[model samples]
Target: MFGPDKCRSTDKVHFILQHKNPKTGKFVDHHLKFAPSVPYDKLSHVYTAILKPGNELQILVDGEEKRKANFLSADYFEPAFIPPKTIPDPDDKKAEDWDERDKISDSDAVKPDDWDEDAPMEIEDAEACEAAPGCGEWKRPMKRNPEYKGKWHSPLIDNPNYKGIWKTQEIDNPDYFELDKPDFEPITAIGIEIWTMQDGILFDNILIASDEKMFAASASSDVLSDCQKKVFDVLYKVADIPFLEAYKNQIIGVIEKAEKQPILTIGVLVSIVVVVATAILRLLFGRKKPQVSCNVGETDAPGNSEENEKNDASAPHPRRSRRET
Candidate 1:
C-alpha cells in the first residue's frame, strides 16, 4: 500500500508492505516513508512501487526512482520481518549457585589509631586579627581541616565467586522458515483506507498489474498527459478570472469617466505634469551657497587706522614678537 501522509509539518509518501508472520500467523507491516520529490497537491504526479521476483523493491515518482531496497534488508524495514534462526531455550535455567555481584567490600580492613573520628571537618583561622589591622572584633572565617578524617569504609575488591552474567542456552527455532521470494502474495481484492482533515483528495488511474512495461506505457500515454495538462490549465484560468475581471472593470470605468469630464481630466493631468517638471528642474539646477568663516575677535571688512591700533593693543602677544625677543 502506498499513500500520501502529512507527518507533523512535512508531507511524506508512505509505503507499507504487508505480510503474514509464519510463526505468529498474524499480518505485519514493513513501512518505508520519505518526502516526495515534487508536491502531489500542487501538480499531478505518477507514483509507482515495484516488487521484483528476487525480493527487490523500488519506489518511483514521475518515473524517477527515489528509493530502492531489498525486501530482506534490516536497514529499510521496522520490526524486522524475518524471525531469528536461534531462540532462547525456555527449558534452560541459570545455575542455583550463580553469583551476579562483581565486587565485594573487604572484611579484614581495620581503622588506624591516627584516624580521628571526633575531629571537626572545618577549623577557624587563629591569626585572622593579626593579618588584617583595625578589623575590630573580627569574625574568623572557617577553612577545611587538613587533619580531618571522615567516616571510613573498606575498599572494594573483585569477587572471587563472580561468574559474570547468567544466560539461558540457545536452541534451533522450530517455527523459523526462509523463503526465496518473500514479496509474492495472493490477491483477491483491492482496498484503500484514508483519514484526512482536508477535502478534494483525488485518486486517479490506479493500476495493479504484474507487467512492468504495461504500467509504464499507461503512465506515459499521450491521452493521460494531455488530460492532466488541460485540468491544470482550466483550474488556473478559473481561479484568475474574478481578480482579472475586477481590474479590467476599474480601468474601463476610469476611461469612461474621463470621457464625460474632459476639462477635469485635463486639469488633473496639467497639475501632475507641473509637479513632475518642478522636481526635475530642482534636481538639475539646485546649488548650495559656499560658507565663509571668521576668527573669534576679527571682522571680514578692513578697519580704519584708529580701530586697527586699538585692536592691536587688545590682542595677545603675536608669534613674530616672541621670535624677535
Candidate 2:
C-alpha cells in the first residue's frame, strides 16, 4: 500500500537467486518459482533475495504496469509486519446510512425554492474563500445536516482591526418555523457575518465545526504543510530572493523609495495648487457681485400693451380709421 502502484503477472515466473561459496570465492545460483495469485503479502523474506547481474531475479506481481520495473535486477525489499484479517463494521453501516430521528414523510421532499431574506434564514456574509494557506477537498450533505466529516481550511486572517471569529447557528425557538425535513432544527443566531455561496463569499468567513477543524489541524502541523508552504517561496523572484533576502529589511526601504519616485508624483502637488488657487479667487470676488433689492411698496409695472393704447388715443394715426368710443 505504501507504493504508489501495483503489478500482477499471470505467467509461471521464475527468479534466479545467486550466492557465492566462501571457500572457492565463486558464485552459486538458486532458482525460486513464483505462483499466480500469490500476493506480495505471502512473501516471507523479500529482502534476502537481492538480485544482481548473473546472480538473481524475481517474478513480479501480476496485472501491473512495468514502467518502473527492472527485470534484470531487483532491490532488496522487506516487509514491516503482516496485518490481521479485515473485520466488518458492527453497525454494518455504509455511506448510505440513514436514521429516523423524527417521523417525517419522504413523499414530497421540499427544497428551498429560493433564498428569502424576509424569512430570517441563513444569511451568509463574509466570503468563504480567502487566501487559505492550505485548504483541501470540500463536500456537502445531500440532505440538510447529513452525517459527514472531512478536513477543511479557513481563509487566512487579514485585518488586525477585527477580533477573533464569532460562531452562530439558528436556535431552537418555538416561534421559529421548521422546514419540511424531520426535526428540522432551524439555525439560530447565525454568525452575524455569515458565510455561504448565496452571498458569494470573497472573504474568510467559513468557520468549521470543532471536529472538522480537528481533521484539518491533524492532517497538517506547524505554520503550513510542506506542499502548501512551497507555493509562497518556490516562485521565481530572481531579482529579490537570490541576492536580496540577506538585506530583507532594506528591500522595503527601496520599495518605498521607488513607489514615491513615479513621474506622476507631482499629480497630488498640482491638484492641491489648483484647488488653493480657485479657493483664493472665490474669496476675492465674493463681495463684488451686484446685490438687488426692491422698495416695500414697489409692484410690477403695467404691461406695454396699456402704454400703446394711451399713445394711440393721444396721437391719431394718418389713416381715416374710426376712433374707439
Candidate 3:
C-alpha cells in the first residue's frame, strides 16, 4: 500500500543518536529508540489461549537491514572516518588467489554456502563452504584492516587491530574527537535507564560497537525509564480488560501521545500564522493606537475632528471648533 509518506520502514527508521568520527565524517555507532508509536499489531497469548486482536498497519524495522544514513540537523557536525581505499592488510597466504574474470552480484559476493540452520561454518570442517567458483575469483576478497579505524566488518568493514599492511596512526582514542575545547566536554547520556535491569542489570550484550557501542535492553523486558516501565505495566494489564474496555481513557492518552507528531506540526504551523498576523497588524497600525483629535478645528492630529473642524471654519465653513481630545 503506497501512501504519500511512503518511505521504506528500513529507510525511515533511525537511531535516536549516532556517534560520529570527528576526523573523517562517519557515524561510529548507533542505537535504536523505543518511543511509543500508534498501537497496531499487539498479540497476547494467555497460557494456551491467545488474547489481543491480530491486525492493523504496523512498521517492522530489522537492525540487519541496510540503508543510507541522513544527518538530521546542520547545527551539529561530526567528521566521518573514511577507510583507506588502498593498502588492505596483508594475509600470510598468497592473499587468497583471485581468478581475475567474473562479475558476481553483491548478494552472491559474501553468502556462505553452508548457511543452513544446522550446517557447520567451521573453517576446518570438510563440509565448510568452499568459495563460490566465482567467489574472490573475479574480485579478491579484501584483507582485514591493520588499524582499528572503527568496527571490524566483513569484506566491507576494515579491521583496525590487524598488525599487517598498516600502521597505527594513534594509540588510544582518535584525535580531533574534540573539534574544540567545548566540543570535547562530556555529554551525560539521557535514557540510560534503558540499560538497567531489575536484577541491578538485565544483561550486558554489545550488539554494535565502533568508537561508541550500541546495546540491547539488558532484556527485552528491561524497562530503562518511567515510560518503558509504564509500557511494561500496560502489557500486563492489556489482557485483563474486556476487548472493548481495553481502550479506556488511558488508552486514548497513550494513542494521542504516540500521534503527537502530527499534532505538534499543526500546533507549530498555527503559532507561526498567529505570530505573522500579529507582526502584520503591528506594521499597519504602529503599536500605540493612532491618535485622533475629535475637535473640528484641532490642529494636532490628522483624522482629528477638531483639526478637521478648525480647517473647515478657517476655510469659510464656520463649523471648525477646537475641542479637548
Give the alpha-carbon lDDT of every model. 0.65, 0.32, 0.33
Candidate 3 local lDDT, 30-79, one digit each (tens)? 22223112222222101110111221112222112122222332222232
CA lDDT for candidate 3:
0.33
Off by over 4 Å in 2: 1-263, 300-325
Task: Write candidate 1's Cα lDDT for 1-325 as tens digits.
Answer: 7866664675767778788877777788877634354453433456788887667888877677888877776677774567668899999999899998999998888888898888899999765665676657767878889989898788889999999899888999887778555745787787878787765455657788888877676556412245444643443353345434433444344333333333234443444345445555666776655333324676534658687666666774455455448
Model 2 residue 184 CA deviation in Å: 55
Best by TM-score: 1
* Residue pairs of candidate 1 with colliding backbone atoms: none
Q: Candidate 2, residue 308: CA error in Å?
A: 21
Q: Residue 321: error of model 1 in Å?
A: 98
Candidates in order, TM-scores: namely 0.55, 0.13, 0.16
Query: What 10-residue stretch in candidate 1 is worst by lDDT?
Result: 255-264
